[model samples]
Target: MNAPAPIRLLIADDHPVVRDGLSGMFAADPAFEVVGEAADGAEAVRLAGSLEPDVVLMDLRMPGMDGVAAITELARTGSPARVLVLTTYDSDSYVLPAIAAGATGYLLKDAPRDELLRAVRAAANHEAVLAPSVAARLMDRVRPPAPALLTPREHEVLTWVAAGATNREAAARLLISEATVKTHLLNIYAKLGANDRASAVAAAFTRGILTPGTGA
Candidate 1:
């Protein structure tokens, strides 16, 4: 059988050392071909257009046109090259915007060489890959807004119930009638796909609508 083509790579980083190191690493591997190198996002975009690399190792912070902007431009132009973010920042500020700008993968600079290589390959295959920290950050922010699933009053009712309050007690605290409390509880159960109050609370906890130590 014919051998598969190497994964063409464009290394983009403001640091010369980082660019050289990554280029050398990929060059030494038969599976990857280092097609070009860039010291900033603008250069990276330029080289990407010309070289048409399979993957671009993009750094989040650069002097001109940060990685996020470059990714946005590449996406706007519909470049075929997939961007795999390799940066030192795992904070939500950096991770969210890069992914939003069409990055195929996000990996920290401290990632093991093997992991980085795997991430690049995944990006080239059009698969989504995120570093553990980045994934956690995304998970924290990606939860459906509680208000979307439950109204303010419904949330208050559920919170009281989760705190072990009876319908009458919740109603008294909220200045509503017991009947209204029961109505809210039924709505909560249906929305949460739970059969009873306990399951509703459990579902709320699982969905991050309720925290462990929170109470009425």
Candidate 2:
């Protein structure tokens, strides 16, 4: 059987030293082919189109048209090459935008050499990969808004209030005393950041804890 073709790579970074290091590392591995090097995002985009590389090792910050913009443009133009961000910046400001702009993976420059190679291979296969720190940041970004501080009882009270049910009615339905219902309402108001029933319901809706046209 014929051996699998080597993965073509385009290294993009402003620093020549970084590009040289990555190119040499991949060159030693027969599975990866160093197709070209780019000094910045614009050059990366141009080389990517011309070389049709399987993967692009891109840096987030560059002289012109930063990596996120290049990734976005590549996606907009439908380039098949997968971009794997290898950068020093792991902050949310950098990580979120690169992923949003269609980066296939994100890895910090401090990643071990083997891990970096694996990331490039994974990106070449169009699989999503992220360095441990980057993954944590992304999870923090997407994690469901910390569950509303309200308890289940508070939620029930708020729902009833939204449905125009009086405290007495809600208490009766929930098998609780009217005084208890009032206490629950007060807690709900505090948690929802509202001063009154109307504002509480509106806030609940805005917070996505309550569906519109449902509590009614």
Candidate 3:
């Protein structure tokens, strides 16, 4: 049987040195193939639209249009390629917007060479590739969603949980029994599509059920 082809990649970075470094990295890997290169966001989008690479290595700051805007545009244009943000900044501001803009992965520009390659491969496979540090910080944007759909009681419970309260503490704060708090948490998980407390918070944030500074 024949082996699968290497995943096609698009490199979008304004810096010639950075682009060259990345081109070399991808060229060395049997699992990856560099299909196109772009100096700015607009070029990135144009190449992505035409070349249809499996993954796009997006840079945050660029000429004409930024990576976030380009990524958003690609999503709006309904491009099939996955976006893997490669930025120097790992802040939530950039990370959340990238994710919201349909980026499949986020990798800091300082990431190890192998990790960057792995991230692109993972993204091409439709997985969310987040470095532990980047994910731990960025994914928090979606946690404890913005506080709209939750009842007042539910919000109270979430706040306590966010404050590192045990079930009994949450129960005491809400004047509810521990079992009742547990039940509410179960309900919250179901409603938020969360697998655990942290996920519940992340989902809530994504759904606007919890706000960032509301102490939830």
Candidate 4:
């Protein structure tokens, strides 16, 4: 039986040191072959077309075309190379776009050598690979935010406010100090992300925290 051929790789980054380091790292391993290096997204796109590597280790913040654009172009042109995003940023601002742009995997620059190698291998095999942090960030980006929590007192205060009661009246009705009513209103404003009583009432109604024709 013959051994499988090495996975061809293209390293694309704006930093010379990163490219050099990656090249050296992969060169040390027999499982991978570093075919070419590109300093920017445009060059990456160009080199990817010519090299026809199995995988492209892309950096997101490169000048000119950027990694996302390169990934987009590669996909648009139907390049067979898989894109493995290797960058320092794991924020939603960075991770979401690259994935949306057609990255096969996302690994942070700080990933361990073994993990990165495995990720590259996975990418070469057309498997999805995501750093733990990147995966978490992606999940958070896709998952809906938790609904706002409101205390019973805050709900009551909002209900009274929504019923068109003045603060003094609400205080008298709730048998609480006007100052206490004001405090609850502030908390409601913050929880509901409302600028004022009217907006707070509106937000409460919108969120189903308050029902129409209901009062405290």
Candidate 5:
């Protein structure tokens, strides 16, 4: 029997040390083949188009076009590569936008070697992966019932949010247009003091408005 093909990877970050380190790590993994590297987000987008790696490990705070911006372009440009974000900050401010822009996973740079490898493999396969704590934190945002600001309809929307519904999915569930869903979300943000989807959910949690339940 022969070994299976390694997952192709592209590492993009501003730090040379981090890029080199990641390349070495991937090389050590028999299942990963690091095919390209980029020193900035703009270069990352460029290399992604050229190398067409299976997964791109992108740094968030790059000099140009940042990770979220680059991921958005990747999605818009119809790139086949999957994005897995690596950032120093685990805050919702960055994570939520990255997800919206089409990153399939998120991880902090301090993540363990095993987990990082696993995340890359999962991203290559189009699966969402995150630190367990990050996932739990995101879940908190999806269903926070805070400040009693949501009307029944807003609450309905929030429930879909809690269920991880994108605006399109939420709109479909509510039998409304996607534009209307965006309108409702804007209002929800105003009422909830939320600047983004993650913050809105977090506000709900802080206000004791949403609680997760295990099916009994």
Candidate 6:
């Protein structure tokens, strides 16, 4: 049986030291072959087109045209090389846009050598890879925001409404004026984003602001 061909790579970073370090690391490993290097996004794009590497290890903040633009250009021009963003930035501002621009993976510069190697392998196979913090940030971005909290008084009014109590009945039971009950209900409606008594009760239950058998 024959061994698999080494995964070809292009390192793209503005800093010469970073490029040299990455090149040396990959060169030391038989699984990867460092084919070329670029100092900026535009050069990265040009080198990517010429080198025909299996993966491009990209840095986000280069001198011109940045990593996102390089990735975008590669995808736009239908390049077969997958991009693995190797950067120090894990913020949403950096991670989201890079992924959106067609990066195969996002790994922080602080990642361990084994982790980065695994990420590059994964990227070569066109799989998604993200640093732990970057994955958490992405999850937070995609997950829906929690519903606004309701005040205790609003909760009480909603509880009563859920229990099928009329505003007048609820007010009499609570020893408050009917108008006061109405005001509370109005506030409850606004808080729960409901238009009327029935909707308010339903919304409250759905949002866990009110539970069955709860009282005002």
Candidate 2 global CA lDDT score: 0.91
Which segments of candidate 3 are over 4 A away from where they belong? 142-216
After superposing candidate 1 on the true structure, give the runs of residues whose Cα lies further than 4 Å from its correct spot: 144-216
lDDT of 4 by residue, 30-87 (tens): 9999999999999999999999999999999988999999999999999999999999
- Give, for candidate 4, the lowest lDDT window spanning 10 residues: 146-155
Sort the candidates on lDDT, descending order. 1, 4, 2, 6, 3, 5
Estimated TM-score for each candidate: 0.68, 0.68, 0.65, 0.72, 0.66, 0.71
Which candidate achieves the best TM-score against the true structure?
4
For model 1, residues 173-205, the per-residue Cα lDDT tens digits are 999999999999999999999999999999999
Off by over 4 Å in 6: 152-216
Model 5 lDDT tens row, 43-152: 98899999989999999998877888899999999999999998898888988899889999999989999889989989988899987767977999997655556777
lDDT, candidate 3, 102-126, per-residue tens: 9999888889987887888899999
Backbone atom clashes (below 3 Å) for every candidate: 0, 0, 16, 0, 7, 0
In model 6, which residue pairs have backbone atoms overlapping below 3 Å? Answer: none
Model 6: per-residue lDDT, tens digit, 152-179?
A: 6667666777777998888877778889
In candidate 1 the C-alpha lDDT for residue 173 amounts to: 100
Candidate 5 regions with alpha-carbon error over 4 angstroms: 144-216
State in Å the error of residue 191, model 1: 24
Q: Following a full C-alpha superposition, what root-mean-square deviation does model 6 have from the true structure?
A: 8.9
Tell me how far the alpha carbon of residue 124 in candidate 3 is from the true structure, in angstroms, after superposition.
Answer: 0.6
**What is the alpha-carbon lDDT for the whole of candidate 6?**
0.91
